[model samples]
Target chain A: MIWNEEYETMPRADLRALQLERLQETVERVYARVPYYRQKMEEAGVTPADIKGLDDLRRLPFTTKEDLRQNYPFGLFTVPLDRVVRVHASSGTTGKPTVVGYTKRDIRTWAELMSRTLAAAGVRRGDVVQNAYGYGLFTGGLGAHYGAENLGATVVPISGGQTKRQIQIMRDFGSTVLLSTPSYALNIADVMADLGVDPQKDLKLRVGVFGAEPWSENMREEIERRLGIKAIDIYGLSEVIGPGVAAECLEAQNGLHIFEDHFIPEIVDPTTLEPVADGEAGELVFTTITKEAFPVIRYRTKDICRLITEPCVCGRSFVRMPKITGRTDDMLIIRGVNVFPSQVEHVLMGIKGVEPHYQIVVDRQGTMDTMEVQVEVSEAVFSDEIKHLERLAQQIQRDIKDLLGVSCTVRLVEPKSIQRSEGKAKRVIDKRQL
Target chain B: MQLEQIAIFLENKAGRLAEITQILAEHGINIRAMSLADTADFGILRLIVNDTDRACQVLRDAGFTVGRTEVVVVAVPDRPGGLASVLNTLTEAELNVEYMYAFSQKSGDTGLLIFRIEDLDRARSVLQAAGHRLLSGEEVSAL
Candidate 1:
């Protein structure tokens, strides 16, 4: 399965024309099939005819994750229930799950796109790929599994847990490609040594496709060292058809390609629904052009990225997006300064004698916002005297202030004191009441 | 002479000691001798390991927070008051002992005690001047 050759390497003139072609049909489909979309367009006093091309995307109302939840379940799905072939739901941290639906055709599109996504990472037929993402309600596992199978590659559906067993299979089964979160990949790398296995030598893993959580370039390098494999990034959400939205190629250059023929991409200011200049950072928006059951229009992804127009080293003409810096809505405004969890992670990884398991606490005291970062001391380090612990806390505080330009109180907690999650780790606890 | 000690800070919970030790086992690292001091909610894990660096890294990557230090490494009298004999001089020198513990029963004829003093150089001098032998990092690691 190859990318639509015309779309993959299309000239700017033709690409824009193709986009306009799909944009027109998508508008009428949403306005006709989905009642919520029809109501949203009506409330905004806009009609299908108002969206003439990419320029008129602004006229259409933006859909957010909250909008998906407000509609809930099948509310946002355009196709009839009988026609839908699959459903994937996000475990919302706040309230009801944000569910996405897909028809048989939509499912096929997802698998084919995911196959292309993995092939770009060099995962092909006969290669044994380990699928470490959790199965069931979460899309990470099954989404990756089908893609590997779609390419005729042997997939090890080794869902999360039983760490010792996972390592055993990676060895006994000769799994050549690893797929999972970046953190878990590192965790496995650290464990391989303990089981009398060398991550760089003993494992047959030639490539690792890591996603479902954000990671830094420093982390990617660290993984490459520990696993002796080319680590690539795959980007997608369940709403936009799971793990095959876009992927990094073998070159590991710039950003991921849009796979735009299937999923139309846009960068918009989340507040005003206006597109930003091409190179500037803004929220990512998508409209499913070829999807059947759930065709979202101008769906605000809330992920921050910049669309690059320059040619990629991989020779694909698809629009590439910079790695997501952080989520727009996830940004916490502390005393009018923007703070991202990833920014804190970068600083923490750079510091010596510091661990990544940290909690950002936001609280209000006397109308002023005070941020406290609780960095858990490694059990070995935590065994030191009280004076050393206090001094280490001071050093971390200084580093945080230096990096973030905000004075945050740093506290040292004992190991195993903080909780760990199975999904995306919740690093921040905000109590600003805003 | 500063003693080399393995310090492990553990949460107030059951099986934490076992967890750290399990990680050590995975790395082919061994704990020659170890000790623990606890408060109401947390415990301090101090141990003598064959490979401190590898042991420290393995525990850290597993999300177990830890660090290391150089204090007094010494071979004292096997009998009681042997420790008091050495500590008495520091006591007279106005140095406060923050915390102190022994290595293990395997360290026969050479029981070790790690100490924190007001000054490292001064503490080394006072102990040396009192005829107390301060062991080197190599000697402590050998134990």
Candidate 2:
């Protein structure tokens, strides 16, 4: 399908009109059933009559993850559990798992969204889509699973974490599309080479949609080069109904088209939780309309990104958001100063002779919080002795402190000493127990 | 001769030892002997407390991992070479002492040596037959 015919390429007027209709109905349904939403709307001084269209969404109160947890399992459901056919839950680090329910219609809507996301990434009919996302609880697997099936492709529901098996399926299945996190994809490439198979030549993969983790663009290019596939970033949350919420089209440009028909998007201040104007960086908020089991209104996503008002080179006419830079919760606060590991990664990428494997250690020494980072030395920059290695560490420390405005001690470790993750790498080790 | 030890697993951090001790102290648990084994990310702290079961329960309820094991506690003369005598006996027994700690009675009558041994029952019987006094749990705690 061409760009114009895709749902992402809908005209601006039609997109807005479609969003308003969905928003009006979603608001009316929530106000009638969900008690927590009714309380929030009453506190925000909004009623079903107030939200006539998308423009009036601002008057309605925004729902939050805490609301879902407080109403854990099925409190937020507009329809009973009998009507709901499926359930998805968060990792529940904050508290009880924030569960989301979906009706058969809701599942269809989700499948259709994933199909749109895949088509945007150029996964056409007759292609083999290898989905390596984790199957249960996480939306990455099943979301891609349905989308590939709808695209008329042979589906490989290869759930994540078996290094050897992943490579085996990619080669044996003749898979044309590989779906996994960027790190796992790179690890798979490394394993393929170790297994004496050429990643660029042996595998038939032409496209990749990687998500469920944060990675830099440098990492993306690295994966693309090793695998020789156009790796596109897929964005989604279980609250908004999984992957295919938004995707990067063929333009390979600065944004992803937000599927605005079933769900409305808003950019808001990370701290105050208020809306910001277009072309500004802020936390993403989503309001799920046309949902039957669990419809959330204005749930804050906590991701830091910017949405572009201009159309893409592919002419999708949809507002494409920039790749997420970082999460507010992941930022480290040391001795009354704020810092992010990604900021350190940005500086390290700019400098030569430094690798990606690093760990932050925070400890209390003599009435002060001392911060230290252990950076792993790759084959490219291996050095001998504490004297020479300490000098290299000092240079890294100076550069990171200059960029991040926080002083830290840097120690160099031998290659592969720092732990690597199959999914999300553990980045921080806080020795100071709070 | 037997030494009572309490082992508690703690996630590596600054105030963990303090937290474990404070929890014991709150419940009137006194530490008779203690040692620590550490790794990069975590540490196992061992203690011989007045009441082993109660102390472990208190720490467990407080979210600290506590465990129990038998340690060799032997009595030697309070004079010089008191520890040396026990060492020579263990050497003859072919027991390689991994780690150890020392404490004394309140009257300064005898010296108590705690040894981590590979064979607890055999070492205890050998030391006892050699006429060494094995202090009971109460004797260690009361001292």
Best by the DockQ measure: 1
Query: In candidate 1, what are the lDDT values of residues A383-407, reduced to their tens digit?
Result: 3676666667777788767656568
Q: For residues A186-302, write the lDDT of model 2, one tens digit per residue.
A: 777778778998867788989888876555688788788888888888788788887777888865635778887777889888888768877788998888877788888988877
Instruction: Score residue A98 of candidate 2 by CA lDDT.
Output: 62
List candidate 1 segments past 4 Å from native. A1-6, A331-434, B1-143
For model 2, residues B8-127, the per-residue Cα lDDT tens digits are 654456787898888888999888777776545445576878888899688767755345667878777798988887787778889777678787776788888877777878778878
Model 1, global lDDT: 0.77
In order, the interface RMSDs are 3.3, 14.1
Best by TM-score: 2
